[model samples]
Target: MARTARGFAALALAVALFGSSGCGYNTLVSEREAVESAWGEVQNQLQRRNDLVPNLVETVRGFAAQEENVLREVTEARSRVGGAATPSEAIEASNQLSNALSRLLVVVERYPELRSNQNFLRLQDELAGTENRLGVARKRYNDAVQRYNTTARRFPTNLVARVFGFEARDYFEAPESARGVPQVDFQRRP
Candidate 1:
């Protein structure tokens, strides 16, 4: 048999073996839901971080008004996160926000009083907690994506996935450029 014909034969065998039990279709449904649920958790954590930003910005602003450029970058990045229409866009925006926030923190290092301020300390603590949660959520989301994508793309399941219009989901990954450690010059003035 030709390669294409053998491939069809395998698919036919897979469907014939699993089709009557409905396991393939049901597994796809369950996995897709798991992925969606994981994605929602990621969004929830992202929102928690988002809600904390303005307070962080304000507290930093009070003591470091001169640091307008870094502050603006953080705000703009947060706005992009809010306005992102897709998972890929949100991932990119969220990465930007992370970078911008890192720059903002570097600015904080320059001012001794800002570091000691109670409000800034509290906000910083809260932001740390939110980042931890966001990290956990992202891990879960990626794990769920792995499971769903595996199921959707696997042998017989691929047939069912195609039949039911279940397409592969995009993973929330940092862009290659963003993956590198950000170069910060401690000597540079904010």
Candidate 2:
């Protein structure tokens, strides 16, 4: 009878240890998932911006046929964003593209007809809305990354994170040049 009791105590101890170990692994997995989900939101918002570009370009084209440089910059920036390899790279490229697009919009201010065009106005509104959504998405992504990184580096969870190959995620940060509204000069050549 005593032998049976000792065996039952040993089993209970093993179960408790196993359960405690699993909690850390579970937390690490949850944190990584949060980061990934937030990244998806950021990507969706970026795609929304990409979808608005063609209409914006067309609207501007009608008013100024000679502004090829600005149009080309927007196109190249779009391509870079499309081809970005990593999440950090994508965020940087997207910000650059947004800055170029902002400069193009400033050029629109020079043409009263373009500014007053209903199509242009509508595209502008849509772009503004997309930018707002992108900002929110970026913030959410950063928050998620922060949480994940903290968990990946914390004591108990860190051990599980290392064992499971869960690494720290980079935050979506805007470049210094893109930290403020882009400066646009529209002075006409004499």
List runs of model 2 lying over 4 Å from the truth.
1-21, 181-190
As a whole number from 0 to 100, the lDDT of residue 102 in candidate 1 is: 89
- Return the TM-score for candidate 1, rounded to 2 decimals: 0.85
lDDT of 2 at 188: 42
Worst 10 residues of 1 by lDDT: 181-190
lDDT of 1 by residue, 62-128 (tens): 9999999999999999999999988889898999999889889889988878887999989889999
The best candidate by TM-score is: 1
- Segments of candidate 1 deviating more than 4 angstroms: 1-21, 176-190
What TM-score fits each model? Answer: 0.85, 0.83
Candidate 1 clash total?
A: 0
Which pairs clash in model 2?
Answer: none
